[model samples]
Target: MATALKTVQSSEAEEIAELVALSRAAQEQIAHYSQAQVDALIRAMVWAVAKPGVAEMIAQQTVDETQLGNYDGKYLKIFRKTRATLMDIIDDKSVGVIEEDPVRNIVKIAKPVGVIGALSPSTNPEATPVIKAISAVKGRNSIIVAPHPRAKLTNKLICDLMRAAIVKMGAPADIVLSIDIPSVEKTNELMRQCDRVLATGGSAMVTAAYSSGTPALGVGVGNAVITVDETADLDDAAEKIRLSKTLDLAASCSSDNAVILVDAIYDEMLAKLVGKGGLVLDDDQKAKLQGAIWVDGHINAKVVAQTPKFIGDYAGFAVPEGTQFFIVHETGAGPDHPFSGEKMTVTMAVYRAKDLDHAIDLTNRIQAYQGQGHSCGIYSRSDANIMKLAEATRTSRVMVNQPQSASNSGNLWNGMRQTFSLGCGSWGGNGTNNNITWRDLINETWVSKPLAVAKTLPSDEVLFGDVIAKLG
Candidate 1:
């Protein structure tokens, strides 16, 4: 009986391995689709988005299962994924044939990466998958998603719905796959084996993707800082800061973890902030929120989106009955200051600066202490000040007069492509991946032959005045 049981277990393991292999092989085949097929895939993805409440359901499931963010905020992210990301790709010329110059006789084309292995985060679980899946469709590639262990259920459900949509829309059934059981070992194996990898979330996973010997797009960790100068409208700035810090309980990558305020407006800003639901805690409340924020030098995952009252209770903060958000006022920037780093929660740190220049300097110091290349926010109407801060801060993205989370993700008044991930160029003093987009996932190769003999040089008379003028 023992021998028979062992044989059965071995056979089951072999079958599982075969299924994975077959799935990968099918993916390889789908990756070679014609442009028309790619368009069909995109259409299917759009159709999936069009399904009533599909996006909402995915977001709701993620929040319910993970307990990391609020449903309403996740709903907005999902809406963005469907409308901003998915629909935007419909008109984008990522795939198919393109004619650049008829005169020069140069044509460029897009080709799919063979197989993509995407690592999704626990936060924004649904949006991550939708983004990567749409990119795959745009590039005519097959994607296999390895969701974070904390988000397996949500990931599985989203993948299932997406697959159904694709099949219903006449695309291959196995173009997108999700591993039901995701482990570090399994994810590492997938990263090693896949043709291209896109990893988002914690630094550890991004590091693993970079070292996996596969072409990879890895996002850097974000600890976004926002600065409010004396020139800023105190009330407007305070309201926007409050909204940005508490949105989705501050689970966003671009959420304002630290606020640097000019001393001239510090008191007024604090007053307005407090009036707009910001909780200024006592020493005991500060200690409680601090404990709830960190665990063994890392941000605590469990307390990320919980109410301040709940976190305060857990941290043993003796406070009034009702508390919404926790605030910590600190003198300097560093690990010693918990708010200086990304809290992934509703907690924010307030730092008073001597002046506008000092606010920028202090903001730079805070980012340098941790988030050098991620992003920064400033609420200012002065173009010079905006340009000055944009130039001085080493971050890849700068948001002016708006919530950092929305602006950094490409929803700013200025036109910028929407993306959940921001690349910190070398300035964040990190690797160059300034922004995550479909174009980054697909590598381009110019298939061109040198024009034979430069198409006959212009006539001497035509060349003399025209060519000389052009040369000048």
Candidate 2:
């Protein structure tokens, strides 16, 4: 029986290897396409967005397969990509030819970056693939995606759909490709050999991509922290925090992991949060959830999504049944208090600060503990307070009066490139990714030169002489 099992596993492994080889071959073929052909591939992807139920079905299937998030929220992300992000790239000057000025004699042009190797995460499997695919096409690049091991089937199906869409739109047949088996070894080989790589997920994978000796665009982990000052509207802040935390069961990296409250309004804010279905766990409940929160040094997904009663029971607390979320109060912020860190599950740590400045200080501490350079939030009308926190946090995204998840992930106000994967910036203390965007996958070289004006001044003379004189 042992020998037979080994044989069966070996056979399966060989099949996966073949699939990876086929994908690589297809990517090579796609690399040979002309600029127009690449543009056609992008146009097909743009048109694919209009297909009824495609995005919705992809999102729902991913949630069902991964069991990590809510289908409704994932559906919204799909629609956002299809209707909003896709349109944003249409007719955008990222691809195609450029004409130079006759006098200036400078020509700016966009060129296709050959083949891209991308790694997608299970948390947002389908959305990540679609975002990468659409962006690659927009940049006139062919791509090969390596889905998370847990999301292989979903990734394969989505890749096929995208390829079919591109071919139907008169582009090359293999414009988008993926492998059925995404082993660490195979993925490492692809990343090292591919023209460029885009990695989205944990710190380990992003670090690997960066060290793969090829240009890589990677996204880091998020541990978003929100601060509520005494002068703020506690009711509105509570609602937004609830909305942000509960969205898709807090699977998003941008989900609010910690809440920093000013001492004057901590009780009031806690009251509103509890009123809005936030379960405050007692000491016994905290112990019960502690096991569920951490297992063998990592956060367990199953326990985090469990009901408050389940978590309480797991932590040794006797409580009512059907508790969906929990809130733990903490006096200070540090790694010793894991609750005060990024709890990806439906749990949050609330800290009380002395004043507005104290709240900012706590927020900084929380970021230092785990968040790093990702995103932070503040619920305040005081412009001074907002600016102060914004400057102090030094996070990539600082949201004001909105849920951190949506705001930090690419909602209208955040000004971040729209995508599920976010670059945690320099503050996350990780050097892998700067930010997540389609442009990050492609290489850009300006094809231009100085204008050849008939009556040009000498090299020492500035173009804007009068403007330069004003400065002097």
Candidate 3:
């Protein structure tokens, strides 16, 4: 048995190695592609899946295969998000000679990072792979995707579609590849062999990516918390929260897992939320929900990304006919309270704060225990309060009076770069704080020329006068 297991492991490693080599060969073939050629290939890949019938089919197939998220959400993400990503990088230069600095007499050239190993999560598999493919090819690189087991077939379908598009565009089909049969060992091997790893999944996978000894860009776990102050439009805030929490049944990491209500408007805001298809659970129901949402200290897989009715029934609680989400009252945060963490379902916890300061404290406390450095949002007409929350909380993005899920990952309403991966910086144990995009898939070389005219350097008095005065 031991020998057989060893043989199986060796075979898997060999298979991954072959995929890596194929990807490397394909990447080299495109090393000479001009900016226009690369852009055309990107357009081809985007149109292949973003077209009318194709997007719907992929969305339906993703829901059927993964048994998570809704078809409508998946479809919009597949079609609109893909095109939106294209729009985001439409005029951006990722090829040779991408930038020039006249003052510094420097020319910056972009080069491909070779093959990338991308680990996509099942929750957003349909769109994540498409986005990653576009980003990789934008830099004239190849990518091999290792998807979650539940979304392997969906991943393969998306990869194959993109590969065909590339082939039709006169590019190598091997530029986009997938591990049709994904395993822990196979994914590990791929990460180890690839030039860089783009890991976008759970904590374990991201941790593994960082540990693979290869350069990697991984995202942090998300437990997005939103704060609503007395100055906020209660009705509008409630409506946006309803839309975000119920969208795709809370499949997105940016979905509001917990909401903090200011004491001045806590009652009114809770009432408003209740009016918007939110069912505030009683103590009994809250107890039942805690048990249902978690099993043995882990989120219950069955409840994840499920409809409110399904989660209610599973938890043995009464869900009203039009109920779109469930709200449980909680006062504390930490491992002892499971609701303070990420609940990937149509359920959220509601907290009451004395004021904006308390709200920020609660937000920091909760995130520190679980989602530190991911993201948080606020619904406040008071700019002071909004800025206060933004400065106080150790989070990446702060959505102001907008839907957290729709706004955090680059929505049309915001200026954020469209992306499937959100970096959490050192706070979340990731490298960058920017939305991971094509800009991250390439390396740059700076060519410097002798300056025709030299500029005077700053004197110590000018540079350090303020610091020196403070010291004195």
Candidate 4:
């Protein structure tokens, strides 16, 4: 049995090598493509998946295959995510000379990073591949996707559509590919052989990518903690929080895992949340939920992205028919209190804070324990409080008065670069602090030209007179 397993592993590695080689060859064909040519290819690929009937088909199929997330939510992501991502990069130049600074005597040119190995998550399989594909091609780079096993079929379907579109544009179909059978060994092999890795999955996978001896960018673990102060509009806050918490059954890492409410308006906010179909669980139900959602300090796979009725039933409790989500009152943050971490379902933990300072402290503690460097949201009208939280916390994105899940990854209403991958910077053990997109897949070269005339540097006295005077 050991020998057979070794042989299978060797074969999978060889298969991945072949895929990488093919991707490299296809990428070479377009490595010198003009900006117009690359842009046209991107449009074709987006249209292939974002078209009306196609988006709905893949969305339904993804739900049927993964048994995660609802159909309507997946459909919306598929229909809008691809096009919106395109819009974000449509006007940007990714070819030849991309930027020039005459005053600095420098010119920046963009170049592709060869073949990119993209590891996609099961939760957003329908739109992630398409977004990554277009983004990769925007830099004239090819990509090979290693999708989650649960969503491999969905990934293949989208890849096929994009490949067909690429062929229709008279480009090489191998530019976009997927691993029909994905495993740890195969993915590692692909990452080792590719020029770069774009990992969008669990912490373990991201760690592996970083260790694969190739340059990689990975997203951090998401346990987004949001705060609602007395100054916020309770009704708007409640509605947006409810929307973010329950969207796609809370599959997004940016979903509100814990809400810190200021003492002055705690009761009013809870009432508003209750009005939005949130059922505040009693002590007994909360205990049952804790037991069902977490298994030995890890999230239960059976509850992830599942409906409220399904989760309640699994916990040996029954929620009311109209309950869209569950709210549990909690006073702690950390391992001892499992509710402080990410739930990945339609359950949110609610906390009470004495004021804005206390609320910011709670948010920082909760994020430090789980979602450090990822993101957080604030529903406040006070610029001072917003800036205070922004300065106090070590988060990459601090959204204001917006649904985090909808706004963190970009939406029609926000300026965030539309992307499925959110880099958590060094704080989250990732490299960047920006939303990962087409701009991340390219290499830039700086060309320096001599200035017409040279100038002497300023004297130390002129530069530091104020400091010298203070010392005197």
Candidate 5:
């Protein structure tokens, strides 16, 4: 991180062309590598980023350079995300003939896409790069990163560590590269030239990735909401909410944006949440907050990724001394009330539900207003309630009594795959409803073989036997 991101980076075309050429050359060396060699390459990358000193330095530098997210969280995030991603793909085969069925005489082969164009956001500069790099290498593909302008230095530092590991292992140093200077034009070109794209950013970046005339896996925004029912453990629920809403100042898209509590437990839940570092705001305070964070119908950028104290001060007030986040009682949902949408900070909108039916209905209305097909959460001991909530919501995932941010995208406790990007699945304008892992980076070649004898198809009369009897 010693060198400035754009000090003498030269022209945009030259930089993109240079990185693309180097990555293509590197892919040639990797495309023919065996599964063992690919695994060794990933091991080298995991080793490079998982070191204590290395993780600490990058985390500190990223926070210093971008002034976003917390140092401690970023440091831990590097290890957790990078190690989990590597573990997920460790034993998988990505080379030729990855699958075979002798009885069926069919085979499935894995082929590298050659090169991937990755777009990472400032919210998770270090972790995103590491995850994408590990994913690309697993499929024997090279990656070139286009980082956010605010986080370019951090991205370069991570890329430098990866390049060092590749070179030491006698692979092409260009297997993983980063743009020295980032801009819209350069990023668009990178998307157009690369064989595939993996985009993890805002709506604009995701839209651009899909429009680049290249195969791309782009993600959308997240406005996760958690529901606390009457039978839930208030203390445990409050603690989980606090942990997620305060993680790196709520930088992750999976961070809780709102909470809906059953009418039976509204008051008790609020009181317990206060003991867990939540500060409830009155209508007057909430009005002031509405003005402070919303500008031109959008959440102001100044309040994003900031602490509760900083946000309170910016809004011309003082938060309680131990306040970790703010909870405002909300009665409305739509464009007029910006709180109903994603805030990207340590603030949450709280709503009271008359019953389970009302809670599910309101949850859908909120999702329809913004952040559909992302995720939702529930905290209830009853199996019927959990299943009912899941069946009612249109979200991609329903986290039960788990921290929305930590476990939504694959965690140690949950079976979800580890990833930095969460696909919104059409509802949020994404193609897939997944955690966006290495599985999305490769193409499979299916080979068909002749069977010893062809089986006869069932007649329409046989297929319709049950229907015909019912009709008669």
Candidate 6:
């Protein structure tokens, strides 16, 4: 996430303290808003950015402002993610009684989680802030954004627009505040001071949020290893992979950084990928690729999330014109084979597998090296192949015939809840496997009445009677 933008606002302590207090006060007032009021507020805020030319303008500013990612993809990202997130919450009851069980005479009430500390990623600067703000407001909670220092202006623009919506709806503008300046110390203080933190950022920031001595939701890393089974349509699989890696120059952490292709279709799949604007690099070119992105056993931030052509040029070679991404043939796994790890750029490691079992094993090894519990994907017509990958791979979600970048977070085409923040399961050091949404933002209270008859378990002797008789 390194960039040339070095201007950081001073007074880190004063900025964070003021924002935190303002957000807390705003949440206290919003706590009393009715369910309808909360819903209206959320809807107004979502559409505020979705208006004509608004998203396109924000998308342009995001790329121009941060000097990271592409404008076209960011444009679509901000538009679709905002609309989808709001759609995901439109029907939900979050203010008062939300769930009830008549048989158990129980009621579940949803309450706001108070003030929220949000850390936005520079990769998807505009979209992350917008989606997180929507979720926070939907739960009747006020949010204070701690944006990536490189993209502070874009994040401020996002918050200012949403705050306008809040005030237009007769709510406090402080309901959605952002530190005018962003810094590490300020973000840390926001997490420490707020009621809860919603962290969507790099691994270090996430770890800090988790260790902030406050309740938080933090995400983990990704080096998605997708498998292309023999039964899969090579053309379709190639297209989907291309779509994911090319989106925002592969900004989404869920992008497929590695692919394990069954030997039966390996050659044909590579050809198909080449046909779809992918350049399969020779060994020498692969070395150049490695040198450009890996520096002293670490991923070089300079090449991360860069265009395929820019990456290839940076590596000292010219990628074919119109090349959407590049694939490097990899022979090993783990740290020794850096290609198997998350490249973050629009480059992937291609592995050949002997059969179905071998493919699953390869996927596991690659994921273990980096993206353990984030996600893996499989493209096949056979249910057995899909299920096999699901059971064998240590991934939080397994996408089937779906583009990883588009489907991993959430999309209208799949059942995955629409979200901007995807939680990597325990394997990825996150609390929940479900995509972060409005559900994660609210607190639940349970009220129950006694049952008509007392409930108790059978005695051990009665449960063991049949077994004892048989044994005797």
lDDT per residue, candidate 1, 210-267, as tens digits?
8999887777778888888878887888878877877777778788888888888888
Per-residue CA lDDT of model 4 for 16-113, tens digit only, reads 88999899999999999999999999999999998989989998999999999899889889998889999999899999999999988999999999
The digit string of per-residue lDDT tens for model 2 on 1-472 reads 9999778666655654554455556555554456556556765664464356777787778777877777777776766655555555554566434445555565556565667788888777756777788777666666778888888988887888777787676665565778677777667767776777888877788889989997877765577888998779888998899888888777777887888888888888989998878888777667667777888778886754344554565667665554446788876767578887777787888888889888777877777887777888899989999999888776877888988887765665555566665676666544443446555655555555654545646653456667767787
Which residue pairs collide in model 3, if any? none
User: Could you give the candidate ranking by TM-score, starting with the highest?
Assistant: 4, 3, 6, 5, 1, 2
TM agreement with the true structure for every prediction: 0.87, 0.83, 0.97, 0.98, 0.95, 0.95
As a whole number from 0 to 100, the lDDT of residue 379 in candidate 3 is 97
Compared with the true structure, what per-residue lDDT tens digits does model 6 show for residues 264-357?
9998998988888888899899889999999998878888888887888788998778888888999788988999998878898899999989
Give model 4's TM-score versus the native structure: 0.98
RMSD of each: 5.5, 5.4, 1.4, 1.4, 3.9, 3.6
- What C-alpha lDDT, on a 0 to 100 scale, does residue 319 get in candidate 1? 46
lDDT string for model 3 (327-430, tens) is 99988999888899999998889999998999999999999988888889999999999999999999999999999998899989899999989999999999
The lDDT for every candidate, in the order shown, is 0.76, 0.72, 0.93, 0.93, 0.88, 0.87
Cα error, candidate 5, residue 379 (Å): 0.9
lDDT of candidate model 5 versus the reference = 0.88
- Mark the regions of model 1 whose C-alpha exceeds 4 Å error after superposition: 1-24, 27-36, 98-106, 318-323, 412-414, 427-431, 448-472
* Whole-structure CA lDDT of model 3: 0.93
Any runs in candidate 3 off by more than 4 Å, and if so which?
A: 455-460, 466-472
Clash pairs, candidate 4, are none
